[model samples]
Target: MPIIDNPIVLSDASLVLIEQKKATANFSHANWGDEDLQPVRREIREHYRNVQRLVCVYCLGSVSAHSAAGAPVEHIVPKSQHLHFMFEPENLCVICPDCNEFKSNRESLVNPVLTANRVNYPRNSALYRIVHPHFDSYDNHIAKFNRLYVECSDKGGYTIYICNLNRFFRRFGRCDELVNDVALAEQAERFFEDGIAPEQP
Candidate 1:
C-alpha cells in the first residue's frame, strides 16, 4: 500500500491560522509548537495515522496508538530548511519515533544541484531520493521479509539507509528467533527476481 492514500484537509479556521502565521515576517518552523497550532498538529497526526494504517512510512513499523508522541508528524522536506512547506499536506506524514530520529533533517531531494534553486514542493517521485509517502507506492520500491527490508530500487535503498530500517537487527544481533520466516523469504526472493529482471520490450 502507498504510505499515505489521502492528504489531510485543513478546516477554514486552521487554514486561516496557517496563513496568518505565514504572513508574519518572523514566521519560522520554530513556531510549529505554538499553542495555537497544537490543534492543527493534532488533526494532522490523527489524519495521517488513519491514512497510513498506523505504520511508519519509512520502516513499516507499527505506530503507537496510545499517545500522540508515538506517531510524530514528519516533514518529508525538513521544515527548518523549507519553512514554507511546513503546512503542506503532501509534505506531512506520521512515522515511528525511531525512523523520525534517524531521518531527521537529511536532504531528500534527488538532485542536489536543484537544492539551492528550489522554491516549490516537488510532486514527482523522480525528484526525490527517498520513497515519497504520497507519490510513490511502497511495494514498488521495497519488499519486506519478516523483519528484514529489501530495496527494489535506489529510492528504496536510500529510504532504508536514511531511516535505519534494520535498526532492530543492528541493536539486537542476529539470532534464531530473528530468522526470516520461510514463506516471507520465498516471497521476498520472488520480489527480488521481479525487481531486477529486464522488462520485455
Candidate 2:
C-alpha cells in the first residue's frame, strides 16, 4: 500500500488538549497515555485501523477490528525520543502488536543529522530508512510471498529486520504450504526479472 492518503484530522477540542499538554512545564512521553488523552488515542487507532484496511503496516497481517489492543497507534518517529511529534498526524498509523513490540523505540530515521534540532517533522521519504507508512509505497520497497518477505530496497530490509517480519518462518520453519503458491512465486520471480534495483541508502 502507498502512504496514507488521508491522515486523521483532530477535532478542535482534541487539538486544544494536545496544545495544553505541550504547554505543560514537564511534558514527557509518559503524558501520551494520560486519562485526558485516552479518547484522542482511541480515535487515532480507529481511524488508522480503517484507513490501513485492518492490515499491519509492517508485515501486512490482519489487525483486530473490535479491539484497540489489536491495532495500536504507531509513531513513525518514536515518541519516547521525540515527544514534540507525539501527535503529528503524518507520524501516526496503526500496526499489529508484533510489529509494535519488535520495533519498539528503534530509530527509524535515515539520517539523525536532518532531524536534530528540527521543529517540524521530516516530509521527505528519503529521510526515513524504514518503509514509511506515510511517505513510501510498501510494495515498492518490499515484496511478499505468502508469509515470507523479500526486501526490494534498503528501507524494506530495515523494516523487515526491525519488525522481524519473518518471525513466523523462524518459529514454524519453512513449509510448502506457506511458500508453495505458484502464482505468488511466479510474480516474485518476475519482480526480480524486471531488473528492479534496490534504492540506495
Candidate 3:
C-alpha cells in the first residue's frame, strides 16, 4: 500500500469542507460544493495517493508498483457512526484496495478515542475499548513477540483477539500465524520507521 511518508494534516477549515460534503463526496470525487472546493478535492486526492506510497501506519506491506492506487482517505475512527469525526484530517489515512476492503466498516476493539470519552471512536464492542489513531501506539496496545504484535500484556488476550489483526493477514495472505502477523506488522513498522527497503524483506 502507499505509505504516508510525511503527513502534514490539513487545517480545520478543510475538515469543515469534508464534513459538509460527506455524503456526496464519492459521487463528486469529493467536490460536493463550493467551486473553490474543486481544487481542494483534487489536492486532497493527490496528496492522499502520495502519502499511501510514502508511509504505512499499521499495514507494513509495500504497495504494488503495477498500477495507480485507489487513494481513498479513510476515517481512522470510521465515519458511519461517528459523525463528528467525518472531516478529521488526523483521522484520514490512505490504504490499498485490499486493506481497505478488509478494514471496511470492521470495528476495531479497544478504540483509543473512546477510551478518552470522545464521540469519534464509537463503542463498537462491550469487550475492548476502541484503539484510537489519535492516541495509543499500536506497539503499546499490541506488543511484538515472534512475528505477531499480540495484545499488550496489560490488556490481556481478549484485547488481542479484539483487534483482529489476524483477519487482516488472512485477507492479505497467509504470511504468518496469528502471532506471526503481529510480528510481521511490527517488522513492517520498523521497516517504515527505519527506511528499510523491500530488497531486505
Candidate 4:
C-alpha cells in the first residue's frame, strides 16, 4: 500500500487534485472504473459474501437466486457522504446491477425504525429519527415484493424521491413479494422480542 505524502498535499489544492484524479481515474467511462484502482462500491458484494450468506431479504434468495451470482451491495446511506457508512454490515444488501449503477452517490434513504407491514415516511414524526441501517433496521422501510423489487415505506417515499426509486421501480415493476417478505421478517423479529421478555430498565 502507498502512504500519502503529507508535504505534497496542499489543503485546497489537495481536495481539488484528489477529486479530479479520482473522477478521471475511476469514472473514465460513465459506468467504468479505472482498472488500476479498486472500485469503492464493490464493497457491497465483496464483504458480505466473504462472511455471511448473501440472501435477498425479499426473495429469501441467495446469490444464486439471481441469474448471476454477482449482485453488488448497495449503500443505503450512499457512501459519498456517509463515508463512515461505507462498509457497514447492515448496509450490505443484495441487489442486481441495474439498481446499483442507477443509485450512485445518492441520499435520502428511508430508515426502517417503526415501519411494519409497509414503510411509512414519518418525517413529520420527530428529530434524531433519521434512517440508519446500523443504528436502525431495514425491516421498517424496505419491503420485499413478490421476489420482484423492494417496496418503499411511507417514509421510504421521501427516500425514493432523492434516490430516484420511482424511476427505477417503474422499469422493474411492483416489488410486492419483497414488501411481503419484509413484513414477515418484521413480524418474526417482533415475536422474538416479545417472546424473550425484555429485562426492565
User: Which predicted model would earn the best lDDT?
Assistant: 2
Q: Write the per-residue lDDT of candidate 1 for residues 134-183, one digit (tens) a residue.
A: 99988788776666677888998999999988777788868344344665
**Candidate 2: what lDDT?**
0.85
- Ordering by TM-score: 2, 1, 3, 4
lDDT of 2 by residue, 84-131 (tens): 789999999999999999999999987776686789999999999899
1-201 per-residue lDDT for model 3 (tens digits): 213334446656766666566646453322333585655545555565565553334443343333335444456655554555545555566555555665666555455454445745332324334334334444444444333444543442333443344554546775445435765566667655764422212
**Candidate 2 vs candidate 3, TM-score winner:** 2
Which scores better on TM-score, 1 or 3?
1
Rank ordering of all candidates by lDDT, starting from the highest: 2, 1, 3, 4
The superposed Cα distance between candidate 4 and the true structure at residue 32, in angstroms, equals: 11
**Who wins the TM-score comparison?**
2
Off by over 4 Å in 2: 195-201
lDDT string, candidate 4, 87-150, tens digits: 3345445554544555555544434333322233222332212233234334455433333224
User: CA lDDT of 8 in candidate 4?
Assistant: 17
TM-score of each: 0.88, 0.90, 0.48, 0.39
Q: Candidate 4 has what TM-score?
A: 0.39
Clashes within 3 Å, all models in order: 0, 0, 28, 21
* Global lDDT scores for all candidate models: 0.81, 0.85, 0.48, 0.40
